[model samples]
Target: TAFAGVDPGVNESGSYAPKSVPTSKRGSSNLRKTLFQAMDVLIKTMPQDDPVYQFMDRKRTQGKPYYVYMTAGANKFLRIYYGRVKEYLSVLPDPS
Candidate 1:
């Protein structure tokens, strides 16, 4: 998540904390842009069965802002991607 810069940013001073937090966006800009684009497509398609779409839709229904839902969807997408990749790699034969 942080690697993709979609992770939430930390904002604190002394004992104070803001009510709203934004993304860290410390990773590659191009990668973030690509993820946002993918999210837009998912929203346009409105795939009810897709978990990412479902998550974003829920956020939207909750009155969350556009970027908020989009970022959340992107984060969810990356998490799913990581899980599938890990599972696939776990089944690979040893190089040796």
Candidate 2:
């Protein structure tokens, strides 16, 4: 398992971080869609402004409906987060 600064626990569940999620009668595709919609609405917004952002910061998302939504939101946030970090790091010269 890959080690993430966000969480140190080795998730044996594989690359599918969303596996902890269990789809309702709506199923995976619907859940994925829900996640996408939430991410689009939430990722750019401030944490205090959105509940999903708060959940991702806690890193304790459940596998039910809320979890799926937050996972999607976190997914979008992390992508943007990584891009911002990379952009910042690229501006600096390497010490080595």
Candidate 3:
């Protein structure tokens, strides 16, 4: 999430937190752009069983802005991707 820069930004001071937070945007812009494009496809295709699409749709219905939901969806996508990859790697035999 942070690696892709889709993680939400943290803006806090002493004991105050803003009502709204934005993406950190500290990672590869190309990656972020690609993820956003993927999200657009998901929105258009409307895959009801896809968890990422469901999450984005839920956020959209809740009145969140386009970018907010898209970024959240991208973050969710990366998390799912990471988990699957980790699971696959764990089952591979050691090269040694």
Q: Highest lDDT, which number?
A: 1
Superposing all C-alpha atoms, what RMSD in Å does each candidate have to the true structure?
Answer: 0.8, 12.6, 1.0
Query: Tens digit of lDDT per residue, candidate 1, span 1-96?
Result: 888898999999999989989899999889999999999999999999999999999999999999999999999999999999999999999999
RMSD of 2: 12.6
lDDT of 3 by residue, 1-96 (tens): 887788989999998978988889999989989999999999999999999999999999999999899999998999899999999999999999
Clashing pairs in 1: none
Q: Which ten-residue region of model 1 has the weakest summed lDDT?
A: 1-10
Position 11, candidate 3: lDDT: 95
Candidate achieving higher TM-score, 2 or 3: 3
Residues 33-85 of candidate 2: C-alpha lDDT, one tens digit per residue: 55456665654664575555765545534544554455545555556767889
Clashing pairs in 2: none
Q: After superposition on all CA atoms, how large is the RMSD of candidate 3?
A: 1.0
Best by TM-score: 1
Cα lDDT listed for each candidate:
0.94, 0.51, 0.93
Q: On a 0 to 100 scale, what is the lDDT of residue 85 in model 2?
A: 93
Error of 3 at 45 (Å): 0.8
Off by over 4 Å in 2: 1-64
Q: For each predicted model, how many residue pairs clash, with residues at least 3 apart or on different chains?
A: 0, 0, 0
User: How big is the positional error of residue 74 in model 3, measured in Å on the Cα after superposition?
Assistant: 0.4
